[model samples]
Target: MTHIRPTAAPATRLALAGAVALLAAACTSTDSGGAKGTSTEAKGAVPAVSAPPSIATAADKALPIDPYLLSYEQRDQLERADSVLVTRCMARFGIQYQAPPQIPGGNRPRSRTDRRYLEMTADSAQAYGYHGAEGDRPTPAPPPPQVSDATRLVLTGSAAANAKSGQGGQDYNGAKVPKGGCLGEAKEKLGANPSNNGGGDAQLARDIDAGARERSKTDDRVLGVFKSWSDCMRTKGYDYPDPVKVLDDPRWSSPAPTDVERGTAVADVACKQQANVVGVWFAVEAAYESQLIEQNTTALAQIRKENEDRLRAAAQALSS
Candidate 1:
């Protein structure tokens, strides 16, 4: 996502801060729906969710991550986090899993997790009165795999036949295929069935599932940051404060930007320059912190402790 620096007028600086505070607060609201449910009090009290350690320190040090070689526990932790996030998001947004609408990129059917996140996003849009006429939330999952059961069976049968005939797995056909057997044939079948080549059909599905898992984990982290930012910003005070008031501000766009874009923008404005440093820093920090708190149901302290312990163990291993 691309980050765009916000340009608010000098006169509206306080207004902007107030607006952000309102946003920070709404992010914390636990009520079922609209105006009555909205309150600033929810901002500081982060739900008791936890987060994994950051992939690397803020210093940009490369953490020792090998996609192909993650430890079982590490992978399990990621899967658990993914499941939790997908389930929560679907519930929050009220997304119907039976028939998810198509999204750009591809037509992958919505997964359970995708539906959940979409539901959450929909509710958020509705809460802000930005509901789409279609009334359907964005599909949280990637495009449904273009391949069908028929396609799979057909390909599998063909491959099996070819393997038996010695005609399968033979190189130099009109189509290009690597020289290998059953596993290789499986890869080829995936590629030919949907004509899906990118990650090699089944390979792609695994990759997407893995990606979803990783993203789920990050969502928790972002939520944790949100809670901390809300708490920190609450201390800064604003006149005529109301969490819903930000919704009234012209600049206050609900779903204020994609999380990543907002995070980058906040970091850019806060960490890169001294101009409007305090407010900018606060905004950026608040973006991450607000996300963490609002989305993360775990306690920040606990998340940090677990991550820190893991980091310590890794350091010990390196030393040993």
Candidate 2:
């Protein structure tokens, strides 16, 4: 699957990885056409459950696409397993390497949609304002272990990492560097390396899922909600085109939330409630995702299977 980073605003950036693909070796299997689901939803026809009731926020509601997606935990596990594989490959070249930390030292794991959408709760808006975090930030992870010029080439499999790194040629310590270096070899083992024409048809499902999100932004239903939200905000002296505009407001950039930021956030949540912005927006996206899922059930099934395969392999790699 293709792993596109979330396009959410910084404040909305949390634990969700959306449709992150798995790392695997059998992803290169041929496409078997598309899969089918029981959903026979006709064109322009949204499924039942148009929208959640008032007070039912995204935090408690999983979208139609959630079942077909990789949770943040699954993505993290696959990545750590990939790192372990890479570390082993590095050992073959006589280089000591440490895998980078995947999860934070102390924090609850975030869900796929914990903060996928904008914060719509009155409490959160009032507490942290546009800054989703509270208290001092966690210490940043340490820098990656430094390697020698020759080691860099073996690690990255990139001749362009530096001039001296490449001059050592493919043969280092009498062992040839894998086609793409250790990283490349690790991906090759998982069959998830796209550059080499690897990967399964599950990418089709991922593309559709990501496409729904991008297209939803311009959807007329969502656009209508944006206007209502904007008008409601104006009544409170917060003149902004839409909620997204506030994400870029230069006034919110600081070490902490200022009084002005808190006030704006409080008003923002109020406007959202007044306009039912979250309710409408969530339903629209759900409809789009539902249609896509119904249209591509076969491919989605393959993705789910491939992910399970990756987890098993990753678990084995971690144990070894």
Candidate 3:
């Protein structure tokens, strides 16, 4: 994964959009739990809706592997730390860099898995349909400020370089662009191994996050719940064989949610609760992650430590 370097700013907050974008983007954009580009605070206000019908809501909470990875807030800290370092580095070359502002909590998902299985609760479904959860959607990002070629070179080592790359060292303005450019240098300083892009363990944590979810889809236990949930959907008059099929339906494939789409989405959540699809599926994947953790305790322990240490450094960097 060659990343786009962040001279512009660190990770902008992301939110999920409504049916129009999600009808097209959900399948692809949801892999990593809904990362996005603009601020988490959307331009408009969210209308209130009735609380979702109560059931086993544990799946809406954290999973076993969650403790090993960075929280949304910690991720925010990493972004702040990266931006701070890059801003400091750019100052040396007389380029003005504005670090991204700190993101307040509750504006972002508490966990990346908050919508992983997409068993969106009824409250959210009633409000946004299949678009996304309460605060889901990638807010549209503004155009990045334009910079000259020389500034670009210093900001990012290559034309498409990201802060995670450690190569592309060069000299400019009587000073060397630290082993990587300012962005990459920032990455290296913040504990990510720019050479490998994730310090090795971080990527593994990501693998665990995505891999376990993908693996759970095929697990027999999940398949069983899918059947139960599917049966429940049929009773509601929807003929979907499974929840996945509902998401893949051509009917909901529109920019705007139809009365039909919202109705179907509501029924989807109702069926999910009636069948406890999210609870069963979440438990199954959590068990899978537990096995993975047992198998990779050494690496996971290291990842946990690195995350804590990195956050500490990030906090110090920001406070200073």
Candidates in order have lDDT scores of 0.29, 0.61, 0.60
Best of the two (1, 3) by lDDT: 3
Better of 2 and 3 by lDDT: 2
Cα lDDT tens digits, model 1, 1-320, are 01122232221222234333433322222221121222222234323333332221122211111121223344333333333332333233232222222222221113211211111122333333222222232224444334333222222223443342123333222333233322234333222223123111222222322332333323444444434434433444322122223224444343334443333223322221212222222333334434333432233233334344443443443343
| Candidate 2 C-alpha error for residue 34, in Å | 11
lDDT, candidate 2, at 179 = 69
Q: Candidates' TM-scores?
A: 0.20, 0.72, 0.73
- By TM-score, how accurate is candidate 2? 0.72
Candidate 2: worst 10 consecutive residues by lDDT? 16-25
Number of clashes found in candidate 2: 7
Q: Which prediction has the highest TM-score against the true structure?
A: 3
Among these predictions, the greatest lDDT belongs to 2
How do all the candidates rank in terms of TM-score, highest first? 3, 2, 1
Q: Which residue runs of candidate 1 sit more than 4 Å off their true CA positions?
A: 1-66, 69-224, 236-320
- Model 3 clash pairs are 4-162, 5-161, 5-162, 15-136, 15-137, 15-138, 16-136, 16-137, 17-137, 20-255
Model 1 earns a TM-score of 0.20
